[model samples]
Structure formats: C-alpha cells, structure tokens
Target: MKKTISFITENFNKSSPDLVGGFQGFQRAINMEKEDIIQEIVLSGLKGRGGAKYPTGKKLMQSAEHHDKEKYIICNADEGEPGTFKDRELLLHDPYGVFEGMLIAAFAINASHGILYLREEYKYMIDDLKNALNHMRSLNLLGDRILKTELSFDISIFLGAGAYICGEETSLIESMEGKPGRPRIKPPYTLEKGLFSKPTLVNNVATFSTISAIIRNGYEEFIKYGTVESPGTKLISLCGNVNKPGAYEVPFGMTIREIIYDIGEGIRNGNSFKFAQIGGVSGPLVLPKHIDTPFSYEDLNEIGVPMGSGAIIVVDSDNDILDYLDAVQAFFKHESCGKCTPCREGNRQLLNILSRLREGKYSQEDTINIEKIAKTMKYASFCGLGQSAPAALLSAIEHCPQEIFKRRD
Candidate 1:
C-alpha cells in the first residue's frame, strides 16, 4: 500500500470541472432541507480534525435546527498546535476546497456570513488564500448571490495571533469576535451561542476541506478508506524523530507501529524508537508496549489517548524524555489563558516541579503533588486546554520515573 494517499491533500493546482463547479453543487444543495445535508454528513462519519474528534454532523444539525435569524459558519485556519502544520498545507494549495467546504456548511446552517480565522504564523499563505477567495468570488462561488440562487453568502479572512489555546473551538470564536482568545464556558456551546450570540458552525481548516471532498466523492467512497467509527483519511503532521518527517494522509485503523516504521521510514539517526506522542502535545504517549494500537478515536480514547490535531511526535531511546516533557509543560504554561485557575496554575506548578526535580531540590512528595494537580486540572478546568495539558507530561513521567527525577543541575 502507498504511504500517503492524497484525499483531502489532493492537489488544487490544475483545472477541472469539479474545481470550477465547486459551488454549483452547493447551490443545488441549498434546495434540500437543512436536515438532508446534516443527515448526509452523519452518514459520511467525518469527525472534527481540530483534536476534539466530535461528530461534525451533530454540530451542523444542532445549528441548522436552531431557529436563529442570523447564523454563522467559520473556518478555523488557526492551526496553532506546536507541531501541527497540515492546515497550512491545505490553505496554501487547496484554498478553493476550504472555501467550498465553508460554502456548503453555510448552506446547511443557513448562514449568510463566513470567516476564515487564519493563524498569524501562517501569514505567508495569506496572499494565496486571498487570491483563491477572489477566484471563488469571480466564479460566484463566494460573495453575494452564489450561482444564481436567492441565497447570498460571503466570506472574509481574519488572521489570528499565534495562540495554541485559541485552537479550541470556543476560544477561536472568542478570538474572531475581537476579544482575547480564551475558551468560553459550556452549557451554551458554539452551535447555540457563538460569534455575537448566533447559531454557528465552527470547524478547522482540515475539517472544512474534508467536507468538500466528501461531497465530491460521496459518502460511500469516502467511508471505504477508514474505520467504521472514523471513516475517511486523516491529515497527519508526522514529525519529530522520524526519518521522513512530512505531512501525510493515511487511513484510520492503521497501527502506530506501521506509521512509524513504514510511513515515517523508521526512527532517525538509526536509533530505536522509544515512544511517540499521538495527536499533539496534549495527546497520549504511545509506549513501545502500545505501538500496535490502531489510530481510531474509540480505540485511542479507550486507552486514554485522543486524535488531537493529528500531530505525532516520535522520540527515540537517545532523547531525554524528561526534557521533552518539560518543554511540553512549558508550552501549556505559556499558552494558558488564565481564565481557569487549574490550567493557569497547574501548568506553572508542573513546569516548576519538573525543573526542581531535575535540580534535585524536590522529593517524591512533589511527584505525588504533580499527579494530584494533573487530576485536578482534568476535572476542575473549564475547558479542554486545562483538561488535557497534563497528559503527555504525566505519561512521560509514568514511563520514566527515575529519568524524570534525575538531577541535571
């Protein structure tokens, strides 16, 4: 089998009927009742790629069913995870697909306005996206009375200052509304009350592009690639200690061992693989013992891991696990929004504890305290950032307790 099969990552550089007629189908889709589109999405089994892995169809149905006069559809281009860049790859090459996905979503949710919250770090790709948006508008795929239909939809671009926390859906919504990008409290989620108190559909860049592909290929063809629970290919930013460190789209249910040894071309510098952090910094570490676990949402969640951001960082026996964990802790510490005390204080405490442990200024009591804080943040925090911040750190410590406590000072 091929290492990377391009589905969502298909090249958009060429001309084709599907390419130009992107919104033409969307216009026809507008004629269908909102439930029709939502049901099709449910049938497709495409989950969000922004780490949450929630049912995209459920979100669309909720927002579509809401009786709101004003509704919104937002593309979260803010791929702010530390090693995540698959979204950047899409916005650069497949801008039309991204817009097309957003357009289809707007039709489903009856949204007149759409926004692409592009990440500030990926500002270099802005011109390409703007050009694509213009090309789309020229073809009547976006902006004002799309494809001779009464439905009028327009999209705008808003760049975001790079903040890892804002990658959370609610936090991204808050950032788009001119507030500091922080995760909002639940009970009124994004679909119910989002972006100026209106029904909204907020999905990341990869999710949007995948929607377009699923529409073009139909759900039957799309579902053939992945597991029943997580159908369709996933865009993974495969990096770290891998020999071939680049983005690749592979089907779900493939084992991590295959991804590392085969697709990744094995560990770099001829070193043996120690572990890999699936899904980004917040994802769980894939120990050598668990390397055979498949990359499916239900399977990983059953083992306390998540398909968060699809950013996998491979580590070898030669690398220091403690240092890697320390860096992970520091990232969460710096990126914490301070809206929730557990995330704000727990990350700081974790980082300090790790540093002090390395300096031989801490005891076993501090390790127990760290574990207690991690547990607190998971249940006590208001949002996902705080809840998941301790994951990789705790895992690394669990696997390498002596190394985590080794004196470096």
Candidate 2:
C-alpha cells in the first residue's frame, strides 16, 4: 500500500523549474496585502515544524506589527538533531521552495534582508545553494524590486560553526554575529531583538518551504490534509531498526503503528518491536503499547511527548534500554554548552547515575537523584538544550522502569 505523501518532495526527482514563470506563490504573495497574507497563514492552521510547534501565523503577525523598518527573515537550516535529516532533503531537492518561502516571509514581515544558516556539515551543498541564488537573481526573483515590484528583499547563506546549540534561533543569531552560539534570555525575544540587534523572524527549512506551498496552493488546499490541530503534511526522518528506513512525508494523523509497520515495513529481520523514539534523541521513548497513538502534537503531548524534529527511531527487542540510555546521555553530555549550571552539572550527574546502574550498583537514591537533576534541567536550564536533554532517559524510566532500575547481573 502506498502510504507516503508528496508535498515537499514532489520535485525531488526532477530539476526545479525556472522561476521566471514559477514561484506564482511568491508573485501572489507580493501582490496581496501583507496583513491578508498573514491572516491566510493563520487560518491555514500551519504551526512551526521546528519542534516548538508555535503557530506560524501568530509569529508572522507579531513581526509584521513591529514598527521596526529593518526587520530580518532567517531560514534556520541547521539540521542538528540526531537521526533527523529531513531538512537536508528539502534543501537538496526543493531548494526553490525554500527560497520562495523566504521571499514570501520577507515580504510579509516587511524585511529587507534574509539569511539561510546552513550547517557546516552540509558544506557540500554550498555551491548548489549559491548557484540557485544566482539563478534566482538572473530571473529577478530575488534582489531589489523583485518581479518589478517595490518590495526589495534579498537572501544570503551563512555557514554555522558546527554547534548543535545554534539550532536554537537566538543562539543561531549569536553565531551569525561572530560569537559563541549560546542561547539568550527571553522577553526581548528574537522577533523583538535578534540578529544584529534588529527585529528578526526565524523559521526552519521545512517551515519556510511549507510557507511557499501554503501561499502557492492557497491555505484552503493546505487545510485539506492533516488534522485540525496539526493541519498539513510533515517530513519525518525514519531510521534506526526499521526495514524501510528513510524520510517519509505523511499527514499529521497517522498512528505510530502505521508509520512503523505499513510505512517503515516493520522491524528488521523479523525482530519484535521494543519501542520507538518520536522526534530526535531529546524526544521520549514510546513503548510498543502506545504505537497506536497518532503522530500529532495534541496526541503526543497528551502522552507527555513532543513531535520534535519529526524524527522517529525504531528499536528492536534485541537492544537493551540501558544501551540507549548510555548513548543518549553521552550525546547530551558532550553537546551541553555549559551555559547553565543545571544542564552542565546535571548531564554529568545523569551520566554518572547511568554508569552506576550499568554496574549493578544503583539504589533507590540514584533514581531519586536522577529525577531531581532532570527536573532541574528541564525548568532551570538557560535554553532548550538542557531542558530537553533528559527526555530519552526519563521516558525510558517512565516506560520501562524495571529495565532501567534492574540489577545488571
């Protein structure tokens, strides 16, 4: 049965058409009033695809309302989450969609400049991206007075220094300013003050691409797919112990079972399913029983999990929970920016506890201590890196307490 949908990947197998007659959506957007464009987006029910799930329309409206004339639009292409590579596919195949999305967002927000923060690991795609930008300029799809209109918006690519923390919007801005990529305190949020201390609008690659689609196809066409709460298709990165592991774009309402069995072709080598981690390493480990849960924000949030980065990693029965704990904890420990004491010391403490558990020396006090540190990091950390760092281990404890706290004999 054909289960995967093709919205973003529609042009994956073909070369992008020239923007001379294409980018009708971009043309449509510039012709419409900015407020109407934002209103249509709000009505479309499109939320941020970059894990935060914030309303895209609300974000645009906020930026548009700001009196700042030097607003900026940023496309966050730092695909840093473990096991998540959907953004790369978008930039690779649908580069035009990304560019058009940025242009639309720029026009709507009344911004003059834009930036695509490409990850350092994706240096290989730099030439192609530059070529695309140059091609757009030749067509007058970019640069001053695009399409002979009064709106003059331009986009440029900025390479990141290989910091996972830069995936966060403010931290990304800090890196663009030639500083260490650490998150800033909120209230003067990115929309109010961001890159170069100007009002900035930041969105992920999938998000910008979706914006172009929404405007091109019209919001009514977009609302036809997915659920009311999470209306629209999502590009999910499916990997780990699955038979057909790859990126699959599906609507928001599909159950995890359908994704793993029907879409992913079930567990590899006939092995029984153990659990699956929805989102990235920071997402929770969902047990086999909960596989029936729909892959939507409200559904997953009801179960205390997030649809982070849309990366689902399936696991087989052969793997032990402790192994995952050790691996994920190690990742957080290494990635911790040490900006906040709770995250820095908390990750180290969680790792220490995991080690003792592996050595069969864990006590009830160890479990209590792990919970203490995770809670602290979740609430007190300076940014999301620390807040979500304990998700995997905590979900492991929640779903398989026996395995996590069992004596390793």
Candidate lDDT values, in order: 0.81, 0.88
TM-score of each: 0.94, 0.97
**Regions more than 4 Å wrong, model 2:** 15-21
What TM-score does model 2 achieve against the real structure? 0.97
lDDT per residue (tens digit) for residues 322-408 in model 2: 888898888888988888899999999999999999888888899899888888888999888999999888777776788988776
lDDT of 2 at 135: 90
Candidate No. with top TM-score: 2
Clashes of each: 0, 0
How well is each residue in 92-146 modelled by candidate 1, as lDDT tens digits?
7677778878888887777878988887888888787777778777777776777
